[model samples]
Target: MSQVFIVTDSTADIPDELVAKYQIHVVPLRVVFDQETYLDGIELSPATFYEKLGKAKVLPTTSQPSPVEFMNVYSQILNDHPGSQIVSIHLSSGMSGTYQSALLGKSMLEDEQTAEITVIDSKSASYGYGLLALHAAQLAQAGKNAEEIEAAVLKLHEQRKLYFLVDTLEYLQKGGRIGKASAVLGTLLNIKPVLSIDNEGIIYAVEKIRGQKKAMERIIQMFEQDFAGQRINIAVGHTANPASAETFISLIETRFELGEVVYPNIGAVIGSHVGFGTIAIFVWPA
Candidate 1:
């Protein structure tokens, strides 16, 4: 039987132990603070990034990995596991150019090497598509081929629902990722914005509520409406906010039958855009 491997970017925000257990290959994106640069989850940890973010006068910037970087990781993977099939999943192309760079890297490979590789645009971000990559890796480990795994992932991508509540819209506004919700920014002073990625992978406001606690409940309500009576897997993601994440997990566990529960920390790159105290909940049928 042929072996299949999973590849994703640091923006996926998948937990380290799961990444290690699945042997998932993650290419790091660049996180820049003035002239200083650090790999997203590598040189800089999420806790450190949040600490710096709290004090920094200016917001940090992020950059996608180069095609050469992707090519190198892919080459290394194939080198170690000769003739293995690779499924490279990535952050939404609408949010970042990481997916396109992955495609270019695939193009740079030898025809034979390229043939065994599949590049996918997750059209989701944070642990939204992060869960997809994890599921794909699980399928790959179960002896599923790249085709079967990709199909399974894409199917879940369509069915999955993700919602995030930001402490403040300031980071998203400054980062220029506010998308459709940019209009209501100035007016939304104490109002928490509920955000989600649309089908095309763009961020948009799902709703705005008066309080943070209410907004979090609203997300669970939305999930209840969407996945009622279904067995599901849940991924709770947070940026320096575990209390809120645990609250979310507790609420979800009571509402649905869950298979797997994962706590994924929102890393530096995505954290830069969402800011601290942001909690994201991603759910799909098990």
Candidate 2:
């Protein structure tokens, strides 16, 4: 059996320690703040990125990694591992071009070599996507074949759920995720929209609760309802909102028997749209 190499983009939000432990390779997206551009996790740490986010006059923009970057990573992995298979898992294609780039890169490889790489669009983001990659890595390390890893990941991907609450709609409006008119109206009405990523990889507003507290409660309720009878592995994601994340973790621990609850800082690419005080819950059947 060939060794399997795992690859993922930074938006998956897998912790650095875990990445090192699992021997996973991550290709970071680019974050542009005015004249300065930084690679997602390479040039910017989450704490530093959030600090600059607060003081920036203009909102930062994110760019996906080029196909050449993916090609280089994949080629190097194959060279090092000899006959190993590469599985590149990434954030939703609908949300970013990272997945597309990986696919394009894989297509560019020679016919015989192409079969060595498998790219998957997780159709999820943040820790939600991270959990999928982590699970894939675990299976690969356990000597599972590429096909086996793909089947396991797709199974979890279908059942995975993500619910997020943002502090304000300003960033969403700026990102063009929500219309300016809707942002204004939502802010005026104090409406906190609970958003979810659908199976198609698009983020959609699921419900609008009147207050933040209610929104938090609604997130838990929705999880209980949709995820009933399912043993879950939960991941809590936040953009500089430790307090809200803590509250979310506490609620989950109190109400559910969660597997491993991983807390990872939302990377710059995803954080740029959600802004601060964003708390997201990622749940997968255990």
Candidate 3:
């Protein structure tokens, strides 16, 4: 039987335990603080990245992995598996070029260096992408073929939803990920902006309200409205904010029937832009 293998980038932020359990391969994005460089999840952890961000003289920046990086990782995996296929999933193309790079790298390999490889743009971020990858890995382990696994994850992607709260818009503005004017205005207004990734894979502000307390309430309100009385799979993501995550999760458990709950800290690539005190929740059908 030809086995299906899974690969993803660091932005997925899938918990380390799940990554190890599923034997998923992860290629990392880059995070640069001042003149120093670090790999997204490897060299710079969420806690470390947030600490640097709090006191850095100059703001950090991020870059997607080069195609060569993907090619190298793919070559190694294929060499080990002989003829198995690769289902390479990644963060949204709207946010990074990692998906495009995965494609280019697969094409550059010699025919024998790797067998068939499929690259997917997850159209989500943080644990949202991670959940898709997690599900894909599970399917692959269950003896599904590459095509079957890919289709399953694509269907799941359509159902994926995320809502995040940012403590401040300064990092987003400085990173150029958010509109400066909007960031400035939101900051001045003391709005706890709620953000979501659209179907097209672009991050857009969903709503803006005052204070963190009300913002958390709004997230639950939206969740209850969308998936009420239904069992759901969820991930609660944090950026150096465990208490906040626990509080939000406690509220979620009270409102909905949760089938699976995963806790993963945001990786540096995302933290470089969103900064600390960021809590995001992703929900999908169980």
TM-score per prediction, in order, is 0.97, 0.95, 0.95
Clashing residue pairs in all predictions, respectively, total: 0, 0, 0
Off by over 4 Å in 1: 186-189
Better of 1 and 3 by lDDT: 1
Judged by whole-model lDDT over C-alpha atoms, candidate 1 comes out at 0.90
User: Clashing pairs in model 3?
Assistant: none
Q: For residues 1-286, could you state the per-residue lDDT of candidate 1 as single tens digits?
A: 8899999999999999999999899999999997799999999999999999888888999999999999998888888889799999999898899999999999999999999999999988989988899999999989999999999999989899999888887888988888887866642567888889998899998887888778878888998899889998888899877877898888778878999888899999999998888899998888
Off by over 4 Å in 2: 178-184
Please provide, for model 2 over 118-214, each residue's C-alpha lDDT reduced to its tens digit, 9 standing for 90 to 100.
9999887888789889889999999999999999999888787888888787787778655322433454477888887777777778887898888
Report the lDDT tens digits of candidate 3 across residue range 1-286: 9878899999999888899999999999998888888998889878888888889888788999999999998988888878788999998887788899998899899976545888899888888889999999999999999899989999988876789888787777777766323533555467888888787887778888788888888988998888878899888899977787788888889888889887889988988888878899999999
Error at 81, model 1, angstroms: 1.9
Q: How many backbone clashes does candidate 2 have?
A: 0
